[model samples]
Target: MITLLLMMGTVSLSVAQVSESTLIRCASTEQDSLRISKNPALFKLRQQSEAVIQQYISRSRVNKRTNADEIVTIPVVVHVIHSEEGRSMGGAGNANITDAQVNSQIEVLNEDYSNTSGYKGFYTDSLGVDTGIRFKLVTIVRTYNSKSQFSPITDGDDLAEISPAWSTNRYLNIWVCRLNDRYLGTSQFPVVTEINNRTQGLATSEDEEQDALTDGVIIDFRYFGRNAEAITSRIYNLGRTTTHEVGHWLGLIHIWGDRNCGTDHCEDTPPAYTKNETTDIECTPVFSDCRGVNTRNMIENYMDYSPDACMSVFTNDQMERMHAVLELSPRRAKLVEFSKITTDELLVDIYPNPVQETLFSSIFTPNFEVFTVSVFNQRGQKVIQDKLNRTSLNVKNLPSGLYFYKVETASKTLTRKFYVR
Candidate 1:
């Protein structure tokens, strides 16, 4: 049973009934509705974002810009919120989880997004597509809080006040704590206007700052980390809970569409009514639906409300939608851009590594007016030079061999090696 928390001019938030309850897998959709109620403009911004995504999808068919080979790394900031008793890391049943446990969760995220084999996240299903996205742990902040547990609906603002997010536009801030035991996790959807320079310039400063205190993902500490059976539930210890919540963070809806026989906006995934039909705890394959027609429920999809062990894939269309969000959504796009430029090395991901005719680059730097790309042969002789007004560079003239490229920006210059085939 779900209880609603009422607040002035805010949407009601549903809280879990009791401790150790696994009925609620995620609260993102609920949180999103609440956010919309608080700020009606957010809904309009999301619709605008959807329009941009549709345009991106139409263009990607010809350019293949969202290719899986071009990886986008998002920097992560983990805030460990623990009780006074759970002050130290790595004790039996400690809320301040160990570094090893944290790193294990990161490993699971990379494996699941990359579709790495020999892991619980890997699947043999043809619908499964590599997302070409990666997460890097930049910093972990541990705070000792007096509260023993947090409620995703009511206590979210309190938690944020205790340990605030690091620039939401740049880093993916994740809070790990002992939740009310009903939910595994929750996340905030990306807001396009807050990140997009064009729309942001037109909006008031107050409106732009509306969501600053409430961006990123929240996870129950017990359900986090891989092989955490010693402290977590046997049904959810494999670290797939984080995977499912992160899918919501990336703009993918529940595979069941959060309604009766509704659509998840992806045609590849079969229609499912599990969102309203019932909470799914079984791994067995079954045919079910809302209307008279029946279709196999996609229990294997990461966005579904299934047991951790049963979830695996994100379909091709889902992959496209996520990639589009990363590209068109300014906050997400800038997160990738910030990751590339903020480091000491001024890192950039250029692909295909062994280029054929065209070479692509990640958003190299933000606010840099002009930059130059220079290429040299194996003998260190300059072969190609051009001003990079966009993310792609033409290497069709270069012969099939190893080459090196240097990107010069106003702030710094970075050189990396690549190949032409």
Candidate 2:
């Protein structure tokens, strides 16, 4: 018994996984010497991406406002590029990614971005900033192939030549696939990439266009994603990997950047950095890298390197920067159109307001993905899926109630609500 208990107690972890309380204590202990270190690579790239994004912003007609005229709701399209090993067609698992996983991820973003998770320790007790960005998973699908051809057209269209790629101006296109050996996630002077990797497990936009890095995020599928139907395999399963990466995509930098010190250099965030260079988060509180100024590192900021649970705040300044990007960046303009594509903002409809069973609707897409429809609840849970071979659905036995229908194609999502009484 003693041996077993001791062994269990000895479970070890890296510095990244330190607890919030311990992170705070470590900051308290290293009150001095946590000087800022120059991570030239990170700094250079950050400047570059910012510059390119600015150029486009300057030229955009929407650059008139420094902040949003209103809280902008962006639609998201997740292209689940899986191995043939485990997809709807593959033997490995459902490979067809369930509506659960998709919905869970979206909910995570909404909660984190809204700053409503009840974790505000990183920022001063008095400071709080709300990033008015809300992402909704269109009850639609935008699946496409690398060629960007139409996908399950009965749903969307085959995403052929995703060139001019899905316009970033309206919709945020997130391609979740098996990483191509050639390119990890991509981000150019302004583009972003998010992918699952082996070594880093998960990583976000590293591009610093100015310094030659692309902007994006990556996650090891082993983390929040699974080849099987959706289920949270572990704590970090739906924790905040994408939230962290999306922060980068929105132009928020790592609070500590390449060094540690009093000021994270972002003026908006407190100064703090970890020199520990480790990634363990399962152990007791671990003291962090040296602390230069009395400033506490925003370890909880989604942008910080802390483990997903430890990081959780976005300051007003961060919001300003993101808002700046949205108003100025070319990709943001497409959001409205994306909303149209994914949510049927175009008003495409399915008859039978309350579907007792048979519900039929035409899914129209200017382009991308050949699709299939999946029914989901308000919680964004998938209730049913009708393959694309048929445009209409026979929802004969589903209990009558309100349900939202999603038409998924390789390139877009088209959704509308109906009744099933």
Candidate 3:
């Protein structure tokens, strides 16, 4: 059983297998309520942050200093938690997502946030602005545990102790696992407030330290990456679940604002009369009005509850809001600044591509003692699998064709495509 303390009231949900047609809860509002309940003072802090963000947005509009040209790269760490049984099953089933699946999600993030996604041309009427934000994988932390399901209500405390968040000031931590209550994902927003009259401005270092421990995104493994084998839902198979959760991590709220005709604080987004229903499968247009002004809902917004196929854009105003949070929030500012650390260290190179015989591999980092290599054919069949105590791999007897290789280390997983002629 999963229970959530929503912003308005308490709600209990009986756990069940989430069908593809069932609605997926973004869970940001429930998460926000829980955080504020833990520290009631956060309520005031969030309000202050919102006010400041609006001011920043206004200033940018007038001065034409939107900072849209300045690209902000966020370093990400994906923590994949799975049980022994799930790991043995493998092949993107449930908790056992492949390394290529993880990287595929990252590629989707880069494309979506940069406005270069393949679906961009589909939403021509209201093509959203590029937020100038890009995500790069810094590390992957894989854990094998006995637990099958982690509680989203508990903020994933069960596995967090084992795979604790890496310095939030530098990396955007994402925990991927099986979630109870059929939730797709959840995220922690940036909320900063002045402590006392003595402090000059912004939140105190003590506040940031406390928030850093829970500062990240949590996703259900089944809905995480863009592999068909991992994601069985045709509506959500494109890996947009993480895209939506990351939007919350960057301080975005639901398009409906968790209320009837409430504002998401973005001027460009049309007022939504209510939350988009999960069964509204065909990207059906919705019309509504706020204060007597007629408007059409932007069900395509990433922050909405619309299906993945229906989601496509983030408005110009939404991009400015995220940029403001990145600039004004101290912890968020530190994230962008500290991400300059060398991410190239995580790169793994596989040599002798299109080879007829032996294939050699080398990792740039010395932290890993051993590596696990798996080769999958174009048909998604694992043809070669081995545990490596050294860097070289022998693929002499494999059938000739295009193949994908996944290299797994203690702290990271790297995937690349190769050809065996």
**Highest lDDT against the true fold, candidate:** 3
Model 1: residues >4 Å from true position, as ranges? Answer: 1-22, 117-123, 194-205, 276-282, 290-292, 342-421
Highest TM-score among the candidates is held by which one?
3
Clash number by candidate, in order: 0, 91, 0
| Candidate 2: segments with Cα more than 4 A from true spot | 1-69, 89-95, 120-125, 139-165, 178-219, 225-235, 259-265, 275-292, 333-421
lDDT of 3 at 311: 76
Candidate numbers sorted by lDDT from highest down: 3, 1, 2
TM-score of each: 0.72, 0.50, 0.73
lDDT of each: 0.70, 0.45, 0.71
> Taking the tens digit of each residue's C-alpha lDDT, what string does model 3 give over 1-421?
3433232111112222446666465776887788789788889878888998898788988998967788999878898887645356345345767778889999989888987775632343465778899998877888876666677657555556657765554568899887766678888888754323221112333434345566789988778878647675666677788999999988898888889889889877888888776755578777788779888778788888777777779888889889988877765775665544455345555665666666654344333234577889988898877654333446778888899888776877778998888
Query: Is candidate 1 or 2 superior in TM-score?
Result: 1
TM-score of 2: 0.50
Candidate 1: which pairs clash? none
Which residue window of length 10 is worst by lDDT in model 3?
A: 7-16
